[model samples]
Target: MATTLDISTTYYKSPLGLLRIGGTDTYISEISFIDHLEEGEYQANSLKGPVTPIVIQCIEQLIQYFQGQRRFFEFPVFQEGTEFQQRVWNELTAIPFGKTISYLDLSRRLGDTKAIRAAAAANGRNNIAIVVPCHRVIGSKRDLVGYAGGLWRKKWLLDHETKIQYGVQTLF
Candidate 1:
């Protein structure tokens, strides 16, 4: 018989919007913003099962991050993707906090300047949002573009990080 994986979900009311955090008892599987809680979904801190430690840690880290008290996350996150997508996500993590990288630059870093579109596609498919820092990727012209969470929220997140890192209000 095959054992089943129990996936637990919880909500977080972030400054930007509502975020849904999902994970197993061992590792976090998803943390993405939700416009609103769906019916039957647990509210913030009202988790049903034994809450995963990593999920709680992700929430704490996110709180600290919004408060400008955390620069790096220590929680472990897992996302299912192709090897190429995995490579793209891994490169995204290397992008320093409060900094931005262009899709072209990202492709070059991946050792394929022609793979810009592929890299950007992988970025859009990233399941883990802020933790993976997909918002940090910008267009080649230094303009904000292609954020799955909406351009306004992307700008807000970049501005937030800039203020936290440079003590300035905004970068753009």
Candidate 2:
């Protein structure tokens, strides 16, 4: 039998865009750039206050991220996917902030150099954005590519982290 969870959802207006955060009573299950999702998925969704504990934690970490104070996320991230995809997502967390890796490299890291397409597919399916760091996966030649959040936002995130990496401040 499968587990059934009553999901709580809320939205946060971030520097990049509006984000929808949702989870069950125990752990955060989804974080997306858009607030829109299938109606049926929202059936179990209980709208949460902006300051709910999990929502507050997510917003705080994201704020700290934009401010260059957070390099790693602390809140639990939950998602359901194939075993391969779960592995891919788990590896995404290992990518350090302020860094970029080629999708080929990510594929190789997953133990199959020929699985570049598969790796990219998994990256595309990732719903938890910043926390999962899917944007860190780039093209072979270091070109920014394949960000569901748009390449502009991807560039902004990479540039933002790079600024923090090089300690260039006075503007974010």
Maximum-TM-score candidate: 1
- Candidate 1 lDDT by residue in tens digits, 43-141: 444564567787889899999999999989997778888999999999999999999999999999999999999999999999999999999999999
Query: Model 2 reaches what TM-score against the true structure?
Result: 0.85
**How well does each candidate superpose onto the true structure, as a TM-score?**
0.92, 0.85
- Report the number of the highest-lDDT candidate: 1
- How much lDDT does candidate 2 score? 0.81
lDDT per residue as tens, model 2, 1-172? 1143366677767888878787665567778886466765444443553334766688789889988898888887788999999999998999987888899999999999999999999999998989999988999988888999888888888888888987654122
Question: For model 1, where is the 10-residue window of minimal lDDT?
Answer: 1-10
